[model samples]
Target chain A: MTNIAEKLNISEKLIATLELEKNSLAGTAHIQAIRKTALGSFTEQGLPHRKNEEYKYSPVSALFKSELCPAKQNACAKLTKSTIAELRIPGLDSHLITVVNGFVSEDLSDYNPNAKSVLVYNTRNTAKHAPALFEKHFGQYASNDADAFIALNTAAFQDVLFIQIADNVQVDKPVVILNVTTTETASLASPRNLIHVGQNASVQIIELYVSIDQNASAINNSVSEIVIETGAKALFYKIQDDCPGLNLITTTQASQKANSHFDTHTVTLSGSWIRNNLNILLEGEHCESHLNGLFILNDSQHVDNHTLVDHAKPHCESNQLYKGLLDDKSSGVFNGKIFVRRDAQKTNAYQSSKNMLLSDDAAINAKPQLEIYADDVKCSHGSSTGQIDEEALFYLKSRGIGSESAKALLMLAFTQDVVNTIRIDALRKHAETLIEKRLSK
Target chain B: MLSIKNLKAGIADKEILKGFNLEVKAGEVHAIMGPNGSGKSTLASVLAGREDYAVTEGAVQFNGKDLLDLSPEDRAREGLFLAFQYPVEIPGVSNINFLKTAIAEIRKYRGLPPMEAKDFLKLVKEKQALVELQVTLANRSVNEGFSGGEKKRNEIFQMAVLEPCLAILDETDSGLDIDALRIVANGVNKLRSENRSFVVITHYQRLLEYIVPDFVHVMYDGKIVKSGPKELALELEAKGYDWIKKELGDVIEA
Candidate 1:
């Protein structure tokens, strides 16, 4: 991989850009050491080459050709209330946190006043206002060695988000985190988020990405670190529907303690290139974790979802189900790994990834792997890729449905399993509406 | 209500319905009985506009319109229904939602306003009981994990819900037990009206005991070889299909 990276030499310009941004990137003196460590790691690793096992399907090295300027301060000051209203989920009452050009906008956000124990703040404010809380959990869950992108985001992100739910507090409403990217020219933004759910606390978070300028060619590299403490229950949803010119790479790492329940749902609607890495670590006994993803690609779009569920303790259960619908010349890749360590006895893990190709030119590649070192563990993984069921289509169409509507209904039903995992009714309905619209086109 | 004139249809290169002719009037029930390869199911499929069977040379008129020219869904919208011997199992699609969509599409084709949600649910309740389908099964994926009896009963349930002008049952009692057969037959009998017609295709005369047909036709090879009153079903059941085959041996050998 290093030899291939040396041959490509695509990291020289990126390294130079990093060096220039190093002096300008703002952070307190306490965070400076963490930043230096991350930068050192990224400098050694450079851009991820195709030879790297984690990025074999998504070639991040090729996207390094353009020299992107870092996002400037106050990039979305012109955004008005009407734009935010258009993006809101109808009938869903939520606490909105807006991130524009990787910058947090407090003015355009709606904080839950009734939930006084829940604190939401950007990284800078967290560092200034809640230094102890920020220092204890910010960089603990996400490691720099996992991926160079996480290291890059840790080192160079201009803005980082921090969400904290107090122990024993049950949030009545969901928290909607809207990440909007807008740029006048080709630029790069790395948004880092650290979320902590205290003992026995329950909360739901939805992340939606929106782009203002479709032709600006923006690159967003984001990292989210979540910590679910003992007895905590958390649901995290990530919905990505960015512009065609954007390159999105997000790595979400969550650590669950004893008896904790954590689940993540990711739905990628459309993007030129998207690579989402979701990792869950079950450290204590009796922990439950689930990861469900749906990616629909068309018109030369490409998406790759790589998931890992690590069972490190006894009596843990984890399940993963990811589906893809590829049409036109689009392609999709799903690589899921479930690992049961030597001490993780009585562990049960099931993983399945299914794909449906709608056109002759559409394609999908799936790799579902299970590695169980423990003899007492039950682990299995399966993957299937094929075209839509012809008999199912005929069954639907013979009942008075038009051909187009029949096709759309089948596609919707195929994705309905993952969509049903969303506990929020309005959010699930909104996702269905978007899926229906995409299928019609 | 339905007419087939010298219809010639087949799958691939082999012809199944060779110059078949049939005429069914309103408020009439016709039963077609035959041996295993007598094209019993093919006739039902051809009437339902299945694309796999090509009408090489045929004319089918349903209520004054050319049924062959319409698509399968259009045929369905035109009040034509076929109760499949093997109901398709579509996972992830709820039975209620499927019926709702089908009813909505049919209503649209007829230029009727969309049915109200209350009325639709009421109709579902009324029709589901006709086939003795449980509420849980109605809420589940269409025919998924359903027992053989449940699947056949669900087919009748769907037919009852659609309320087509012309209904064709293709061996609905193939795998059904005695109780399921009674329930399904009773459901079909309840849907029988003055304006509706039926063509029941089966091999046994046992089903005819429940939903008695007005006419019983013995089809040998491709076309009808014998036509008689309801007593014909009992006679054929007692003597078996050898009587018809022996009578039609010269025609088949030709």
Candidate 2:
């Protein structure tokens, strides 16, 4: 195995090094056990290459060249006041959690401690303490058979977040998780998060990613695993507005039980290269899942979205819609797949991907597919990629709109379909403002 | 105030309008009645500066300016408006927002300040009432999911908002019921002023009965073969365009 690791290329070498380095954590038995199990799985599977079906569009080989060490736990290394001020949304100052370089900082977070049903633990050290609880749930859902990146992420789980909501508890305030990356050197960082919602519990979680420095070419490989127990509901929103020099790979895997509902919205605005994988597994009957995303790429940015909805039980419903606006030399890729097992009868699934190319040089590759093995199911998939309507443009121009303002108006209208899907009013307004700013530029 | 002399236009290499001539004065409603493929829409598109229609020869003068030299947007700012037969459906852009932008843009072109939001909303309400458009429909995306009558009324509403010096309604009466025709015609009548002119392009005489053009022209084979008073429309409706074809057939044989 060592000889095979040495013979492999740069990405393989990085994976091998990460697998070997997991043993040197010198943490408690639980952390060690989890790391060893993940490393073993990674060693058996290795990193995914271009030949892998799931990662055919996103290549992660370039991320392995840089060496990234686990961030040190420093209480004084908190986010600045200016940075916190800039991270303020319209109505999101009450419940916020700021994580800098994978570690949660107390000064930057505003979560109230008096909430009886909500519990927030910095599992970076908790995993070392509670070995049984950590081992029981960690790395149990994401498989390493097809995705090498997920395997590598499991193998190198550094700082982990564990959020638990008690049974039937409803949190009125939304939770905002701000992930800020400020690195001057070439490095890799993985921020692992796990969310558990008990029976009949409901919550809203917002994740924001921003870069502090522009010169550093950092690699962000993060994973968020969520479990919605029976009759639970979870709404997850992720906003990726990182600097153009960063490379990002994020995976969100969610599991729902009977009568549960889960909704995830991902908005990608800026990144040199980004790949997002979202998977919703309906493990019980009468489960509902909604996946919505919007990506606006300019210049030479590349954004790819690969999503899957697995209906394992009967009477499950899923809806997915992703839209992309590509300008300049940017490129976009969207591949959404829905699967219904043989026994998952009465399944209703709908998926659509629409893309608009602003320039002739910009390109988009969209594929929305469905695989249904059940006889009593309603499933449909559609994809369309085209330029803006010339007649519409002429209509606006003939109404005295200038070329730029006309383009901006049309682009804003194009993105409204996806923005209207947001159920949260504040978040929807914020997304609209960000989209307007990008289109104006 | 508008003159098109020896105007020849076409899409690609196939010419549609050959040596067409027309003159429209201020405050006059001139209706161009033609059969299919007679280039009625082409003349309106050319006047409104649609780039798809290439003018091979001749020129169009609008209010002493070279209309052919301006882009569609510039021509629009110069007080030229085309009420399309098939108004575009722009999803996500509310009708109020679209109209405000259009009005603001035209005002800016004329060296005026932006309108106050309160004043603009007031104007929207007024014009919307003039067209009998529902307030709910005005708040939605532009012409999205609108009925045929609603779309035509929305076009008239926009024409009223912009208050263009020259308005061309191209087949505005097509696909309209009698009730819709009355509402649309009433809206046009309310917007009629001595300072503004209109060119109503239609195929049937039914629309002419309501809008009541001052002059009516019979266009065949891309050129106007005869011109007369408003009664000509009634005559053409009775004769059914074959009279002009036979009259030209004898000329060609001679």
Candidate 3:
């Protein structure tokens, strides 16, 4: 990644810009070496185009324009807590961790800086302070072989937000990583994050992406690698709402050990464009994983979610439910894959993708794939896309509920099963408010 | 008070209700008895402002207001209720929440504030007992996974809660057994008041046996062929629909 190639093989504008960002890479020598390998992979595969197998519906390359570059260092320096406070949904009591354009903004964050049970720092600093731990798992989980975007992020990311929980530490307060990408110009922010939960430790991490300065557009290609140790429990929360000029691509990879529990929820109420790739690897026995997602889009917004659950060990269970409610000309896609290894006997995996379209022009594509090499495993997947039930709507309206409230209610019901899986109570309430607002629009 | 004059309705070019007419004052329970395909349900659908049914020529005056001028929700807010023949099963909307929202919207329309939570729960409990609904069913999704009898009882329960002035029970007795029918009819009878009226549309006379109607009209080919007292339902039930067809033929020739 450090050495720039004289000639480029692909004509993608983002890939060309990535090649030019060779000398500006940050972190330690170890990360620089890994960045080299990742850059090589990205340069070889290039940006995902229209015909790319993974991006058939979401042509990620088309979003890249020559005007879009890495945002400057002092992009949101004028942003204050009061201005960002207006965007907050009420009733959230958590230790706030704010990151502006991938850089940790301490003055904007509210967490304890001297907490002994947990440590939160940018990876560049962590790479110097906690060198051993950083080298062990920094670039280990997120694969670059197939996904060019992940490699592109890894090769060009300047800073990484790192969080580590000590063994047997039960952090009561959730850490809200509020990321605001100021898009006064066409800008791009590739944020790299790593969360390591120690043995028997439990925590919740909420990654919220919101946009400001909407005169121009921005793209945030973020990658977060989570390591849940033995007997640990984690809840990964992602909420995207009221993002007017943000195009987001996120890949979250979680590796669980024996007797670990990992639950992830992704809710997208408003965004210009969004794509989420969640990959869970259950390597040890008796692991449990639950993935729930809800995306309610209108206007011309788009959101694509691709999830993969790999059951490599026996006695593991995983359940996934993703639902979408689309209106106007908005579109969405859901692709879920479950793979059960041969030795993973008694594995139980279930996935369902349910979508409802309020308008005839709105569309959705749902695909569920399951592969089981073990005979004793129980795995099933169901995908369904439908319009709002006319009978149900009439039934509601006939009861004195107006059209707007009725549609919002019905859309909330369609997403209730998935939204209910949100573990945080206040966060769940905030999500309901956000979802209802989006639906009513 | 309710009045329907020269109501003609259909579904996408296929006319069903041709020159239908009816009139009922306040507190009058009108029973519309008709055979299958006689446009009985179409009349109920059109009255409730269902978008599928287009009224090409007609006027419905309810409480001195043009009913056709209001949306279905506004009609409900104006004290019109339609108990569907086959109630829709909404999977994720709890019966209690649905009721609360309906009451809130209706109250809002009437220039009143929302009911307090304590009062709302109290009202729910009272309404549940009217239809013998279990306490658990109030928390469950609206009519979801409910038995046939339970669904009908839920409709009556909803009708009890809303307390509509003009309640249209469209074939509410079609799928009820004797015990369930008695329970549901008992709920409706308890809700009947001097200020509230009902139009019970049914094929059988068994329901009329419980909640006797003020008037029974024999409908044939989208028009009332015979109008008489409540005994007319018993006559039609015994002689079947052929008697009405023959009676209409004689009138047409005259």
Candidate 4:
């Protein structure tokens, strides 16, 4: 019940203690070393405040007041068959992994026994084996230099998934990961995951979040880092559909090598307060990245999406489109930025954010920005926030469509551009159903 | 089917239509011709119940009801149609869908059931042919990416579907080629019947050559300065509006 200022003071003290403990760990000079260093940096940074450029509209002090603790060692034991059934999503029965309370459950995961090109390992004990690989790449792309929430995630990291795709291999089926949380009281849980795609490899990954109980007010802090090597391709999707009582903060960072392709779709349905930070860094030439998002919020829900695409090499391309529908007293925010470095010539980057407020009290704040040091690049950004056209409403209402039904139809049509971007037909249909349900209510 | 008495309307504080009066009985076609700034379009807008135009004085009666008192949608529901000079292009709504909504709204106002989808599609096809509207245009977004002629044809096609008791064509022939003009006028002529009335507003007498008017009224400076039969249009066409100016000047001197 502490105010946000007092809560932040306590969090700062905790971060100091965690940092001192992290510095005392003397592990093998391997990949774990890098993780440990990253953890130390995160502890020093702590959660972001309102002053941070990236987290301007999304404040994390309120989240810290929950006093969240890491999931228990046997947290996976609480996951039951019924829980999995309730969390079942479209095209999710094929090959999937279920992580409950930040711990992986073998019974809930589908692993291919004879799969040679794909490898999935538990990085929960990264201090022991595979230290060298973890040290070189762990936290390299998702740095704590700018964002405090990401740093806080690195400081409190516990169990995380490690996935690697071999060169020249193509995974026919997508990898689905469901992160479920159950809390008895106000607490915080940080779940971290890293994915690496080798050169010329192709894969698809989907991450989903859910809450087991509706009334439990929990702060779910999650981070994911992905690396795509030269000529590799990766398709990533993250779906955030939690109960209205849960406060969720998620960060995803990705790096693309030469001629690599990375695409991500982030869809948020409803939550008490949700913030997502997605950053993509094109480190090699001819790399491509696309980031798309859609959110539908109602009541007093608040959803904020912050995305950045960094073009470091020449001849790179990136496109981003985020659409939001806010109803009742809901509020939505989108801040998308594209930075083209001085050497990144001929970088084609485009970003657009469009929002529709269904009610007079509903609000949206969108800022699409571009910083181009290279003059030859084709970079543009646009943002628009408005209500549904009244003339269009009258036009539809005159056709015998009742006022409410006409509003719903216009809203659905307005969101078609974002919904149709879902590559998977089943997932797309599922998202459409969720949207219809949200609009109907 | 439509009548207006002492209609004084304006936007903001500026009175545009000062004590205007008009009447159109069923099966009659009345043309309101005027020079520039004649308030011909303002009369059409006031009748259609555009919220921006205030009717400070007077009343409009349509189908034995007070038309001015109803909302625009309600007026449309009461079988009153105004084909805008510049039809709005609603980007995502299809023409067929818009027409169906209009028809259904009118029907609902009359306490009729919604039309079956199959029957509605059949009706759309029939109306499209009646106006020579392309099938592709009907399927596309309403008036979006349409040529001038196509937009006008689409408006008339909407009228044919709604079957309004009173139809007001506001400068419907402003931007049409000769062929397009003929096609549009022919569509309007086909929709004329004993149960419906027409109010054609235009600047020139060209459109009247095809859809001949029963009466013609010359509007000047926001008021009707002259009224005559169809021959007045011919005489005006023969000697331009300057002749009317001279006639007005001579009357003032007397």
Candidate 5:
């Protein structure tokens, strides 16, 4: 750790841990050069403080201020195929990849590795297996220059789940990356994932975070970079239903080429403290993007969702809708930023953030920022925050529905629009079930 | 079947219904005709256990039970229905789903098992046909994007399905055209029976021409000033409410 960054409150314990991991990490010379550059950035710019606008609502760096990072540790013992079988989420008909802690445990996963439509590699082996491809896209879009967490994450790792879709071949099933964290102590996990879709190929990716034990204390600093080629389409779903003891800061960045369609739905069900940074860049013309998110929180849980849609090309359209239902003392934040470049004329952008604070103590902060240099563009944004509609609740109760059920119906209705944006029927049903389970409680 | 004694209710600090009293027996339809701001809607809201209205000095009894003690859903379970003047539009909740849930809950409260799917569908079909409601409309979100006539007709359709014993129509005829008023009155007329009663509150006597009321009461300044037979409606319609207000004016002051 550099002396200047120490003034930024980066813990001394964290600095020592990173330096130890930096010496022990093994990678190719080219990948090492990338890590060295990331380490240099991390040394210069430490963890973010409250002064940073992005980290204003969430003090995620506070978790690392006192204790060593948990990403590289927390290897669960006795996680055999039989022991981990109970951790698998059933009923998802997709190619599954299970990453226990930060390691891709093949014994606990179910996927066909020999499939010609795609190539999948674990992080530890990617440096030796797909050195050329890994050197090109890994760390390209999710630049760690400004983000301290990304800088530290890009430098420290045990494994990176790498997936590459072949050109002109449509994958038959979605690739499900299920991150299961199990540790005895308060562990930290950093799972860096990279996905690249070739030209004319279409694929679906579902990243699920789960904790085997609800009482296990852990924090995950995860980042995934996706690059979509021309004429390709992709559907990405990020579902966070971890335990209360597990906190998370996950960043997903994607860049799309010409004529490509990308849709992402982020559903945060349960967690301790979660901060999600989702950024998408329309690098080519005629690209379309849909960003939808739904988060239902209770107790003292906190979740901050920040998204960016950069329309760098002409004729690109994007729509964002994020809805949060907060009960008890839980708090939530939604910050959406849209940037339309000077040449990106004919761009259409719409954003809306709606929140329902069930309790008076519960709070929400919603911000919609738009910057457009183009003259001929249509952009609109609005935000609404309030309690459940008492009139609607009374209307339901007058029809013989109980108060709890009435509230549930209204709450479910509030999240219906964003939930309906999910294209996959089964996944949508799964999301509905997850939301229903929370509301019913 | 339903009785309100000295019902004085209001929203916030201002009391709207000063001293109201009414009783409706089974096999009878009571038409409460009054001008605007006469506490007609307050009586409806209070009867339905709306939390906004506080019943400061009154006792409402429904089927031998203290109605004020029950919750809104309990009042509904006790066979009390209020067709709102401005029906609320709740989006995302399908109309049919809402009805099914209401029916299931009401049935459960009555110690009855869940209704068979076929029977529920049949009941829905029958009630929809009675109100001339489209199947698509019945299956859409509850009263969402519904016209004035359709919303009124939907209230009657729900009343028919739930079979409420004492139904309160709070200005259900305020914004309806002639054809819509006819259809709504037709639906209500079909649902009337010897065991069911209705409190049809309206500002216009034109609605009574279709479904004649057994008793007509004129409400003024939160009190029932006059009570008479159904002809009283025609008399009030012919000679405006000024005559009654003038006569009752002396009595009110004294």
Candidate 6:
């Protein structure tokens, strides 16, 4: 409390709540040292304001003004095993892990500890069981100096998940990580995760954020660090379908080794306010990356998606496509930045951002920035923002289709490119059904 | 079956179709031949309920009902179809899916139940053959990446599927080669019936050689200046539209 009391406006009350939980948090000296350093960083740099470049489109500071407390592990009393079983993607077969209020539920997870070459551990237990692994890669990629939310997550996170795959081991089924937040009062949950895929290994991961209580007012600040070794392939999916009372900020940072392939698809369906930051570093030669996103918003919801692909080595390639469909008074933002270093020759990068504002009251802001230092590289970007094509609408209507159905058909077509980028069949169909339902309304 | 009297329509402040008049009975195909910018397309657009065109004067009647009182979709449901001169390419909307939905909506408007999937597919197969449309093209997005021939043939295929009573072919022969024109005209001829009528608007008489019309009219300056038999199209084609213009000198305004 004393450390945060000396800080500036909105964040003062936040740190006071964290100070009360600090006394009860049990960890080894090594883990405590890490928390102390992170808290020091949080004290030096408070919550970001609008002046902050990365936080320009989002109101991160205003979120802390609400009367909130850290989410308790026992606050999810309304949930049971059957309660979450119905929330899973119908007919999707995968390994499931449910994290309730930032606490890993072993009873709900279908992980087999006896299986070799694969391991899953809660960060609270990693400090005691696998101290070396936890100390080595815990905060290596997600830098505390880069953003305040990362530092705050490091200092006050209750439980974290660590997933590891052995060398040359390809998992047949995907790992589904479901994060659920259920609280009786206003609360906040910070869930941190670290995933490491070894050389020549392949895996797929899906992260879903859901809220059990529709009336629960909560905020989730989540961070994930993924490390893909040489020749590894990994596909990650992030789906956000939460209650209207929830505000979420998710940051995912990845570093790829030589010849590794990494792809991520982000679908944002419903939320009050959401901001996602995706950053990937091509640290070795010939690495490839793909980042695609689709967001359908209505009501007064708001979403901002920012992405960066840093080509630190030569012969790297990346492609990005983000499309938004907004109706009513909802708003959205897309900012994509690509950086090619001096030695990163033969780099190819492409980016496109398209948006459709269904109503005049809806709006969007798009910014695409590319900084290249290499002499031999190919980079191109395109952006478009407008209403639905009236000619196409009339063409459909002239065939006897109603105006609403015609608009839905055109919107579904507009999002087809992004949807096709999803490799998983079931998840892709699920996104399509959700989008059609949203537009049909 | 259809009649237009003193029809005056235009876009914005400029009038295109000035004091137009026409009448067509069932079991007849009428060809309206004229030069470019003579309001042939404007009449087609006005009849199809294009909102961009405002009909300031005159009235249109179809089956004894006021045709101007309906929206574009209602007009479509009332058995009125327009094959666009430049067919719109709508990406990501499958041609078959669009036709299915259109048929279902039209049926719903007529107080009938939706067609079953089996019956719908059977009808699609039958219609696809009449226009020589490929199964792949029928399943692809509407008019996207289609050649000129495929686009015109697709228009006729859609007309066959919807089975409109009064079909307006608006410059369907503009961009077609000889072979495409033959195939399109053949498809239109196949759909002809005793109870259905067609208003075929073309600049060239080559399209009518395959599907002969019962009546031929010459449109100039937004009005029908002459009415005769099908031989009028051949006469205008052989001598060109200049003879009609020279004969109506000073009688027709620019």
In candidate 3, which residue ranges exceed 4 Å CA deviation? A1-25, A84-89, B249-254
Candidate 2: Cα lDDT at B86: 95
Candidate 3, residue B31: how far the Cα is off, in Å? 1.3
**TM-score of every candidate relative to the true structure:** 0.94, 0.95, 0.94, 0.86, 0.96, 0.96
Candidate 1 lDDT over residue span B98-183, tens digit each: 88999999999999999999999898889989899884755599899999999988888888889999999999999989998999
In candidate 1, residue A286 scores what lDDT? 99
On residues A199-229, what C-alpha lDDT tens digit does candidate 2 reach at each position? 9999999998877772355677788889899
Backbone clashes in candidate 6 total 0
RMSD value for candidate 4: 4.1
The TM-scores, chain A only, for the candidates as listed are: 0.95, 0.93, 0.94, 0.92, 0.94, 0.95
Query: What residue pairs clash in candidate 3, if any at all?
Result: A1-A36
User: Any residue pairs clashing in model 4, and if so which?
Assistant: A30-A131, A31-A131, A31-A132, A31-A134, A31-A135, A68-A187, A68-A188, A399-B101
Lowest-scoring 10 consecutive residues by lDDT in candidate 5 chain B? B131-140
Model 5, A130-169: lDDT tens digits are: 6477778888999888588788778766677888898987
Error of 3 at A327 (Å): 1.4
Collision pairs in model 1: none
Second chain TM-score per prediction? Answer: 0.97, 0.97, 0.98, 0.96, 0.97, 0.96
Candidate 2 Cα errors over 4 Å, as ranges: A1-9, A12-27, A62-78, A125-135, A214-216
How do these models rank on TM-score, best leading? 5, 6, 2, 1, 3, 4
Native-referenced DockQ of model 3 = 0.87
- DockQ (CA atoms), all models: 0.65, 0.84, 0.87, 0.24, 0.89, 0.79
Report the number of the highest-DockQ candidate.
5
Which segments of model 6 are wrong by more than 4 Å?
Answer: A1-8, A214-217, B250-254
Worst 10 contiguous positions by lDDT, candidate 4 chain A: A23-32
